[model samples]
Target: MPIISVTVGVALLLVLMMVFKLNAFVSLLIVGLFVGVLEGMSPLEAMESVEKGLGGTLGHLTIIIIFGAILGKLMTDSGGAQRIATTLIHSFGEKRVQSAAVITAAIVGIALFFETGVVVLIPLVFTIATAARVPVLYIGMPVIAALITMHGFVPPHPGPTAVASVFGANIGLTMILGIIIAIPAFILGGPVYTKFFKKESLEIEIPKGLFNPKEFKEEELPKFGISLFTALLPVILIALQTIVQIVAPESPIAPVTNFIGDANVALLISVLVAIFTFGLNLGKKMPEIMQSLSEAVSGIALILLIIAAGGAFKQVLIDSHIDKYISDIMAGSTLSPLILTWLIAAILRIAVGSATVAGMTAAGIAAPLVAATGASPELMVLAAGAGSVTFSHVNDAGFWIYKEYFNLTIGQTIKTWSVMVTIISIVGLAGVLILDMFI
Candidate 1:
């Protein structure tokens, strides 16, 4: 009965958001409350759950989200992002530019979260597409594929990070395995799948001035080396932290390393450095830099709100004992733990449209499976991560970002973006399964 009620509540959420054109944030809140009450929580309890969920989610993410936005905005405005794109494009040339996008996105996605990477790279992708005179999907697919793959599979991003914590996965091993899986997933979902889209009509009329490179002289943009370094700082710091802990656990600098390597602190430092390197160092004034930061925050406001609501819905599911429900069912199943973990996460992802929510919620359900099946916790983390990103459609903010950024109609977005993500998901699952056999 509880399972059926949960399913119906999720269905109602979809109907309200899609058919009635209701706001996703409100719909999520409504569904979260409805599900809570259906599961026998008092109305007051449901309300408290929603409030607690919202506060907890936002509290954990607000710093990272805001700082990431600031960094991306400053990078874009100061032409550092453009510098990286231009340098890479010239080096790769028009012929290999699409491949360059995949590599570039992987590098950037390692440092920036998915939303920040997308915002920073959107204009660059369009610029490459226009200059190459190719369909946006040609360049866009590889770029999006790389970003999504990294965001889903890699550490530091919320989904995999939280799942790893829940499942007691080795973060360093998970990162290593994630990169191995991501390579094939990107190739299959991105460049290979792109062949199918190339045959179709791929006309995309971007919004006015969307991809136009800022009016900056050759000397105005940050140098390629510096720009790339700035963008990759977080990854480097985090990597150093991991290395130091492994190599010299009691080193006096461990505390300093931890501080610099903390995700939020890393991003905050990056943003501060960028304000100088991408802004003041390039002659932009304080007010101009502040304006860019303000614009970045405004653009992500809705996305942040939606994520918060998804978190609320996720909390409701956890508090409502769905994890217990799932654990009981899975305990009796004979399926491979890897496949079962992926299935649960994928279903939750489809229902909630938030990868973090899906991964975290599924992690809670699958935690006991780790002990029951004695599966590698790292593989479980990857499996859950893969499922969390399975199919992005109308309910996911990422779907809308791709649709609006590429100026695709609903159908076109599904045909390209949705299909590409599905490919990523399936390939990711396959990669994890294949690795399971050997490892």
Candidate 2:
């Protein structure tokens, strides 16, 4: 069965990486091919799927990460990152650093794509952790948890927005409800969960080349307002798009918002803005700015490859028709439509490695159940949204991104990134169930 093969494939992948220590990119490639052939594809067809997956994923991710990395690199070298870090540390103090990270992520993540938020905000994680004398995971995990929670549960994010549309849920109401549900979920999953970790979770090396966490003295740092603006420009631009789409969908300026608010375009604009704000305005030369861009691209070359390979593995599983198999099996279930949709989306999330893909696919199965089971369409949307990010593991690009950016091994990622997402998932479900009891 495809499910059995997929399970075996994931186990073998961990064995290859954790036991034998193969390069992650190569390890993913090997397993993608292995799983494809095991599921009955010929070797040549599997190779083509892998190539297509790599191309498709890179096509979208490359420019975004390139700009994001450059933005991060400029902030890192110019002490913009330090300024933000210092402000955060001073405002929140060392003990509450993770709280600061969570709040920052929540604000930016409301509009920014999760990947964009990660690249932009993750640099500050290094700075904060270093300045506060804490582990990178301590600050970083909560940041991602908040971002991922919003990505999975809230509207304007592709996954939940698309799922809401399919369910005919009121987008505005769904968003309000989502935010209400998200608070406790991220609080427990992010800050509280990190606090319960063993002392060793407190130790992590900042990833080399990706960021510099220099603790610059106050005089050397740029003004805090400009640094914060530089980091938040993308959020503002993207949020404008969503606002226009909802408030004035047919406005003449909608076309303009759509253009600039595209993630790639927004990041590019942010980079140019950063060039001036963090670079030229600071009296740095063009060559120095260009040099920072070069270093940023170089730092992520390996990270990009690992992300593509993850996409490849996901493509191979997708090609094997595992989602169809699972859907067919669950079609006759009589569970609560909310819980059933959540289960299907959660399983598909583990199977497909993309929350949007998982949520949309689950929508196809649960769309009819809205009428059949008498569940509220809004709650059903929230429930499916919850499940779409459950148990991120080897098949997920997000899992690899977290692993690479935070410089954690598979074991550490499972313990931190993986577990944190699961916590958010469960909280979302329970919260939805509680809300369902009333309305």
Candidate 3:
């Protein structure tokens, strides 16, 4: 089959799944089979490829994502996120809730994965918006926007990490660029946009039992300072490792860099801290602590499954040589890898309704092109991350979450959340392109 035919077929398959409401996992599996057969593989070979792809990809990411989800759930359920938000809001003052929302979201994003972060913070967002007598969108957009920015651009989060790994980017450089891009993107998509949304005055009843404010009774809640430190410990350690490696290449810290700042190590430390701060110190029993941990991890089952399926889809694309063919075709074009990465990611994101999938698939397809052209791996990764976050629609769970939570019509959700996401995507791509010029 012609490469164009394969591309169109794959595109159509995605659209049908997303638009016609087919299951994404099933769609991906079917698309993979179709692509494999069309590419001349035998039926048996295609089925084997599906299994191999799913197993291999899940093998790499399952533990990391599952653990990350658990850590996030612990923090959230234990009121750690509330501690951060309330403290920040109080410190920033009511007039600057927008700024506070953005900061909290960024911090939470660094600590938690995208969906986990959203789930954790949405309650506090509602509380704050209510107290301020503003539309929920006013508060919600800034927080979610900040989370999206960090999830796309920062490390320790799976999207950027996956992109960095695929592109051979320096984790340190990617982190640096991610922060730089994140600040501006957050401001644009967040506080600034919040002002506009506030004017619309959409009311949403705060969900009951979202967070038990009583849970934070003076003696029950961890000290705000301790909770903040515990929340940030992993990110701080990872950033320290990245900085040391970049600045002191031969330093003694080199040996321990991976050990101290590795995802597993950082998360382990956070989990331990959570036990002490939220469980032991809070007078909870050992059994309760264990239950909390298990519950937190279990909440992430759907996220893990979706991510695993995405990985499987990516592997299938690789096995079919579609990635290589696309790389070859784009290699001769004048399009910069940065722009190309973003565009491909955006297209896939809009088509598939999963930013992680879009990022992973785009990175896989663009990796070969980056190698062929000697493009900066860091820029390529950022571009792919940016692209993966373009336009959100009804197909995207985030879109519906925002719409229902904020009580917005679909139009309003698009006008606000969708627009903010598009801005993040575009600004992120621009940031990568500008950085490319200098680096």
Candidate 4:
């Protein structure tokens, strides 16, 4: 009965979102309450579980998401992102433009979320494609692929970072393994696969006013060195702490390093630096900087609500015994935990159409399995992250973003953008499995 309720709960969520066209926040709340009651909990108990989930998830994530958004907004608005793009394009030149586009996108993507990164990098994608005399898809595929991969697999971008918090995965370790997994995924899905795109299909016009680089004067952009440092500062601080903890276990600075190296603290510091470097240092007034920060928070208000709702749904599953029921079922099976984790996330992603929602829900369900089997939380995070991005088609906002940006028909989008993400997913799963062998 509990198992049936679990299946029905997910199906109801999909129908509400995809068929009825209900709001995801309302739909998730409805499904959470419905499933909890069906699973034999009292109605009040179910509601309590939902509230607990909402508070727990938001308590851990609110600050990180807000700080990340502020930094990203500052980076985009102050011309720092354009600075990095310009430098990478010049250094790579026309001959190596493909590699350059991917690198620039990856670096920029790290600091900006997937959607914002796309908005910032689209101009550069078109610019590079025009300069290299290659098809737009040839260059654009690598750029989008790199950004999507980072959004799923890496930290400080919300999805992976939030899942890491839920599963107790070490942020530093997840970042390390995610980078290792992401490089090959990017190469295989981005540049390598791009060679096979039909020449005729690549002939798409750059959409007018889709964030043109010419809008900003070269002198107005920040220097490349400062831009790059500001963008990657959080990653550096976190990685440095990880390395130090491993090598100098008894150092007196451990406490200080741990304090600063904390993901929340590191991002807070980066946000402060960005406010000074991109805002004040660029001669922007205090009011202007404050507006950017406020607007950044406004943009993510819906996303935060959806995340909280998903967390509510997650709590219902955990509290109502669905996670345990599923864990017990898996216990009797011979499947690998990593593969199982990926499959569950992939299924939910296909159903829910939001990678963050799918990843969070899947992590909640898979939590019991990790506890029962003693699986490595880091690999589980990567595996779930990998699944959350698989088969990104019509349901995903990214699919539409790709389609509209490239001016592709639905079929063309499935052939190009969808296929690229499928490749990333497969490559991500394979990487996690391989990593599991040595660890």
- Candidate with maximal TM-score: 4
User: Residue 304 error for model 1, in Å?
Assistant: 3.0
Q: Which candidate's lDDT is highest?
A: 4
Candidate 1's C-alpha runs over 4 A off are: 110-137, 154-178, 196-213, 246-252, 318-322, 336-338, 344-384, 393-415, 434-439
Return the lDDT, model 1, position 271.
85
lDDT of each: 0.79, 0.78, 0.76, 0.88
Off by over 4 Å in 3: 133-135, 170-173, 196-215
lDDT of 1 by residue, 1-439 (tens): 7678667776887678567878777888998899999999999999898898788777877776677667767877787766787788899999999888888888777756677677778888877888888877788878988999999998656567656766777665687789889999988988998887544476567677555444778988899998998887766776677778889979999999878877678778888888888989888899999999899889767756766776677678778887567667667789988998899889877866777667765665567677667789999999999999988888888999888777889998888778887888888889888988887
Please give the distance, in angstroms, between residue 424's alpha carbon in candidate 1 and its true position after superposition: 0.9
Model 4 stretches astray by more than 4 angstroms: 209-214
lDDT of 1 at 417: 79
Which one wins by TM-score: 1 or 2? 1
Q: Name the weakest run of 10 consecutive residues (lDDT summed) in model 1.
A: 205-214
lDDT of 4 by residue, 1-439 (tens): 6879878888998899899989888988999999999988999999999999899888888887888888899999999988998898899888998898899888888889899998888877887788789989888999999999999999887889878877889998898889899999999999998778678777887777655444778777888999999999988988888888989968998888888888889999999999998989888999999999999999988878878887888899989988888888878778888898899899988887899888887787787777877788999999999999999888889999999988889998999898999999999999999999898
Give the winner by lDDT: 2 or 4: 4
Prediction 3 global C-alpha lDDT: 0.76
Ranking by TM-score: 4, 3, 1, 2
RMSD (Å) per prediction: 3.9, 7.4, 2.7, 1.4
Q: Each prediction's TM-score against the native?
A: 0.81, 0.63, 0.90, 0.97
Q: Candidate 3 — which pairs collide?
A: none
